[model samples]
Target: MTDKQSKAREYVLADLVDATNEVDDAMNLLTEARYPVPAALTAHLQAAREQLAAALTIAKQGDAYRPRCAHQCPNHAHTCDRTPTHLSDHRDQQQKGTHTCSWPNEPDHITIRISGGSDDLVEVEGCEGADEFNCWGIGLTGWRGDLIGGTDTETLRIYAIYNGIWTFAATASDESLPMPDWPIRITDHPDVGHSALVEIDAPAGTRLTNVTALGGDR
Candidate 1:
């Protein structure tokens, strides 16, 4: 995430915390009020609080979820540490050109692989009930494709390269709507070639679902 995006997320989290606190205060006041508070109003306020709390929890959990290191450090004899704090310090050292062997370099090849099917399509596990997903690839000859949702049957055409990485990402406001059917097609792009391999990324705790897609169909 860019610095701007990080700041935006922080702002949103702050807002959610404030909203939750306000709701708590209202509920407390109602409990202490001399007059009886309407039961319907109290229930509505409680529901809103629950939703905000759930959203806050989810926001805090993701944005850092990823597979464990694929390579081990020669010096430390352990996999690279990708914790937020360690990664931040490691990045700073790299920029300063004083990096050491704290973290091992990422493998040139993809650590997690999506088994490809006919027509260059692949099934990305852990996508059922996901509100958003990010697809990235290394050694990709083609950079454009479409993502078809399994349950909702929605198709998202994507083409982009972020920070020099071939990437395509999407989000849905309706969290209830599950996106991406099990096997999503990677349309052939003769202009560039085709996808060699891909890594599918969904938010942490996303449920896994399997489905079949032939030539980008159900």
Candidate 2:
């Protein structure tokens, strides 16, 4: 590679390494607390640390070479300053290893247009099964540049059957959309549960290339 290209690659690599290492150190500090730490905080720390690690891996594998992203980025075509996450192999083999559902072997084949889900939405069948779809969550592609995942980080309210069809709300970090692509169980979220249907009201003209669902817990 030319000197300029080499410098660019080094810069990208440094960014990746710094991000991953910072998370690792923070997690260590939190976990090595002198006093008791809240389980919730600890859990969040670990997840962040893992995400950074994964991003580092992808960068090492040359994600910088991907098509130039329209958004601001130091490297050519790279989207997020940090590694954009996807379902990991372990996660795929065992949807967080917390629960299971009749999840498709892959994302939905047919493109689904989310015009508020009344008529133009897709559903994961067999979710009616008790205990199935425990960490019920849905996501689509193109929420991020070309990535098939959620929009900016967000929290969402969903209807699920705990005893009867009930409403549950969940949140994700970092500008994540209400319904992030990550697996999130809909119970004991920061909301009141009431008998209602899962509501999906995305902005107008939002088209989803594919839909994915699986069982997991927050």
Best by TM-score: 1
Report backbone clashes per prediction: 4, 13
- What's the lDDT for candidate 2? 0.32
lDDT of 2 by residue, 149-199 (tens): 333333332221121222222223233443344332211213332222222
Model 1 vs. true fold: TM:
0.34
lDDT of 1 by residue, 1-218 (tens): 55644554465556557766877888899889999789987885675565455545644643322222334223222324355655642311222222244434443211222323323334343343322223232212112234434333444333222222122222232455554322222222233332223344322233333222111232
Instruction: Determine which window of 10 residues in candidate 2 has minimal summed lDDT.
Output: 138-147
Model 1's alpha-carbon lDDT is 0.38
Name the TM-score of candidate 2: 0.31
For candidate 1, what is the total of clashing residue pairs?
4
TM-scores for candidates 1 onward, in order: 0.34, 0.31
Which residue pairs show backbone clashes in model 1? 149-180, 149-181, 150-180, 150-181
**All models: lDDT?**
0.38, 0.32
